[model samples]
Target: MSYILEILPSLLEGAQLTLKIFLWTVVGSIPLGLIVGLGLTSHFVPLKAILKFYVWLMRGTPLLLQLIFVFYGLPLIGSGALTLQRYDAALFAFILNYTAYFAEIFRGGLQSIDHGQYESAKVLRLSYLQTVRKVITPQVLKIVLPSIGNEVINLVKDSSLVYVIGLGDLLRAGNVATSRDVTLVPLILVGVIYLLMTAVLTFILRKLEQHYSYWK
Candidate 1:
């Protein structure tokens, strides 16, 4: 317990990093995922194929590998256009990986809508974009929210993975503290931090679910 207390401030700092990574990843991924999801279902076969390929590549590879590739391999290639520092590379990898998963979820949600709704919107003189925005998006959100919330919760934990790339997230802080004391107390403390984060996220997501449910 003393060891845990000793490392409290350090762990708190790391927790902030974890939160930053999680929040940024979610923020960047969601809208990008929506775009990818829409593109995957586009009428243009070439666009759909390209989006599908992107999703496949991101999903198919391990995230760690992607991180390494982005940070190391890309720089090795002449594509200096996307030079990324360690933390930046981790953030990029996290965003890309989560975006692919979210895209699939969004695609599923969009498809879950009845084809008749689109037809009805067209019959009522709604433009295609208007039908998607006004009619389809609302229904898709209802269906996808639970799943998206689950992924967001998962992201809170997965942010720790950034530590592998030298981004000092909560778990990394625990590792550093434990190394100094040769005690497992820091790890346990970090676990508590994670539990707190997950709990708070769960509560918020539940509230969001209820808020959206009213519209349904």
Candidate 2:
């Protein structure tokens, strides 16, 4: 117990980093995903094909490899390649990966909307952007919130993956503790923290789903 307490601060420092990654990834991915989803379903054939290929590439690759390539490989690829800061690199990989996932989720939500709803929006003389904002966006959010929430929880766990590139996230902190003190308790603590974070997110998203259920 004393040993666990001794390492708590360091673990917390790592947890802060984990949280930053989670929050930033969530913020960056959601809108980007929505845009990609829109592109995938758009009338522009070449644009749709390109976006689909991008999605396929992101979804098909291992995230760890993505992280490695962003942080390590890009710097090697060409003379003018931009080397990213460690956190920036992890953030970039995470946003790209999660955006692909969120894009698919949003695509499913957007596609589920009745075509008649769009016709109705047209009847009201709404522009495409206005129609999306006034009619389609609300419906998509209501439908996708639960799924998006699930991904948010997964992001909490996935943030640990950043440690593969030496970013020292929560899981790595626990690992460091165990390696130094030869104790398993830190791992248990980290697990509990992750569970708590997920639970809170679940609760919030459930409420949001209900709030948007006005359409139901």
Candidate 3:
């Protein structure tokens, strides 16, 4: 027990980094995902095609590969023009990868909206922005929240991937402890921490789903 207590602080520090990465990725990806979703569904053929290709490339690749490419490969390609620090590289990869997934989810949500809702918006003399904000956005949010919740849960786990680039995330911290002590307790603690975090997120997401359930 004393050994576990001794290692707890370092593990918490790593957890903090993991949380930061998750929060920033969520903030950066969600809006961009919405924009990309909009672009995918837009009438402009060229723009749609470009976004389609972007989404396909992002989704088709493994995020771990993307992280490696961003952190290790980009610097090689452009003479280091896009060199990012380890932390920044992880965030960049995570946001880009998740944005593609969220974009697809949002696109599906947006498309599922009844076409007559748009016709009604036009008849109401609502501008495009207003129509989207007032009519379409709510429905899309309700539809996509479940998927977004899934992604958010995945993000919590995926933040551990930052350890590959030496970011000292929770899993890495646990690994370090286990290596140093030659014991598995630290890793077990790490698992407990992850389960606690996911449990909280599940509760919050369920409440959100309930709040939005009133729409149906």
TM-score of each: 0.94, 0.97, 0.97
Q: Flag the better candidate by TM-score, 2 or 3.
A: 3
Give per-residue CA lDDT, model 3, range 1-216, as digits (tens).
899889999999999999999999999999999889988889999999999999999989888889999999999999989899999999999999999999999999999999999999999999999998889988999999999999999999989988778799999999999999999999999999999989999999999999999968
- lDDT for 118 (candidate 3): 96
RMSD of each: 1.4, 1.1, 0.9
Clashing pairs in 2: none
Q: What residue pairs clash in candidate 3, if any at all? A: none
C-alpha lDDT values of all predictions:
0.89, 0.91, 0.93
Look at candidate 1 and tell me the lDDT of residue 184: 89
lDDT of prediction 3: 0.93
Native-vs-model 1 lDDT? 0.89
The all-Cα superposition gives candidate 3 an RMSD in Å to the true structure of: 0.9
What's the CA error at residue 79 for candidate 3, in Å? 0.9
Ten residues in a row with the worst lDDT in model 2? 74-83
